[model samples]
Target: MKTLQVDLGQRSYPIYIGSRLLEQADLLTRHIRSKQVLIVTNETVAPLYLQQVLDNLSDFVVETVILPDGEQYKTLDYLNRIFDTLLTHKFSRNASLIALGGGVIGDMGGFAAACYQRGIPFIQIPTTLLAQVDSSVGGKTGVNHPLGKNMIGAFYQPQCVIADMSVLSTLDDRQLSAGIAEVIKYGLIREPDFFAWLEDNLESLLDRDVEALAHAVERSCRNKAEVVAADEKEADVRATLNLGHTFGHAIETGMGYGSYLHGEAVAIGTCQAADLSRRKGWLTDADVERIIRLFKRARLPVEPPAALDANRFIELMAVDKKNVDGNIRLILLKSIGEATLPVGVEKALLVATLNGYGRKG
Candidate 1:
């Protein structure tokens, strides 16, 4: 078992990552003070690992609400269902919520817990690799609105994050690839050495090598934890973590929710950011090629969705959360291990880059 700690002062918590971390009752006993417990999951995951969590929390009064799985279901209407479930049960502030699925369930459950009587305790049992490495770490929780992804959300931290790698065995290839995209981001944005490390061990990771997966999960969590500890509310330094998000969110939103996986869009978006950097002479083509090569190895999409047009792309991006005043503040590449926000990217350059987006037809 591998344990990574996210130190947020009083709100600090542990993210337990390993093969069988899910079945440990004591893993959650310390943080859950309530007898009333609600475990939130989706249809797909409910059939898989819900029993493990329920058995672990047998001492507590466990209630459940299973939503249909997918990005399209991540909306206010679905989030309201959680409220309805909690209200129907008469769960009080003393109650606790457990997010037992992937990022969607975790975000919605955490948000529901945060708003339920001005915040109650919640635990994150992130089942997906993407959820374990990204959503389960930063404490950013919310449901997506039609206009943007995670545009309407809160920075509510969970009491703890339990990441059981064993659950990942049931995940489909696309979901696994979505996770590797995030792991790649941690390397590209913060740790140059880690980036090199990924370049060396791509095959082992793709094969689900236990040691590789554990190290990747731990290192990615560590990078995110450091950023969260430094800037909990994304004041400035933390926004760098949004590296390819401005364009990626637009891709996800414009393509609609389910067209591409969140990490799939992010994979292509990172490629685009690197391309933009190369165009501006910020990153060498060699650097860009290496980044794309790694994404390909993970089976992640490295090209944008073909349906996007430059005008629509720009219009959607204008509304990104990272935009300040009227100008879009993009997190572009500086090098393999570094990134930054250059003041105002040119319109022609942005349009041409969008026009040149290459991917499967």
Candidate 2:
């Protein structure tokens, strides 16, 4: 097992990444603060791994909330179910929540821990690749609002993250590909050598080579931990982590959630960001093509939906968290490895990319 720390001083926590970690009860039990525990998972994951987690918590007063699975279910309405379970069971502030599914479960479970009795302890046992690499490490937790994605959330850290690689064996091909999108994001935003490595070894990752998957998860988590430690609240460098998220969030909110998986939308949005960067003379035509090819090779979508035109995208993007005083700021690429922080671009230029970048002339 390899352990990495988030390094938030008082809030610091370790992320345990390895195979069959669920079999290690101590890795999870040591983090729980009290006897009362709530395991928030979804219907899809409950049958597969819930019992393994339950096996570890046999001594605690445990309750389970099996949420309906999908991005569409990640809302204030569904989040209240966790609260209902907590309140019905009269769980105390010292009680810990175990988010035992993918990103939606992690986000909602963490948010519940953050809001219940003002705060409580929680641990993340992220079952999906997307959650393991991105959502689980960062303290950013919340449900999606109808107006914007992740607009109502908090920067609440987890007690510890258990990224058991063994659970990924049950993940479908599409969901596995979705996770690779975020893994690829780390390389695009900062790790140039990692990006080059991905170019050569993506096939190995697709084949679920144990060493390659472990390396990708560890390296991606390391990159995320370093950035979060420096700027926990996204005051500066942290915003760079949202490289394609602004446009991607727009896609999620515009199309209604779950139409595109979060990582699929990010892949498309990053391609658009590369297009805008090319327009601004930051990336060449070859650079844009290279970026698109990688997402394609990963089996992710690289084109924005035809249903969302420039005007609709603009409306949706205006509601983003990164926007300041109605100005829609975006994280664009300066190069393959270096990403610019959120910056305001000319509306005309932005419109041109939104209108022309992915559409046939």
lDDT of 1 by residue, 56-117 (tens): 88788889999999989999999899989899999999899999998899999999999989
Candidate 2 lDDT, tens digit per residue, 10-51?
A: 999999999999999999999998999999999999999999
Specify the poorest-scoring 10-residue window by lDDT in model 2. 145-154
The alpha-carbon deviation from the true structure for residue 345 of candidate 2, after best TM-score superposition, in angstroms, is 0.4
> In candidate 1, which residue ranges exceed 4 Å CA deviation?
359-361
Clashing pairs in 1: none
Candidate 1: deviation at residue 353, Å? 1.3
RMSD of each: 1.4, 0.8
Looking at candidate 1, the ten consecutive residues that score lowest on lDDT are: 352-361
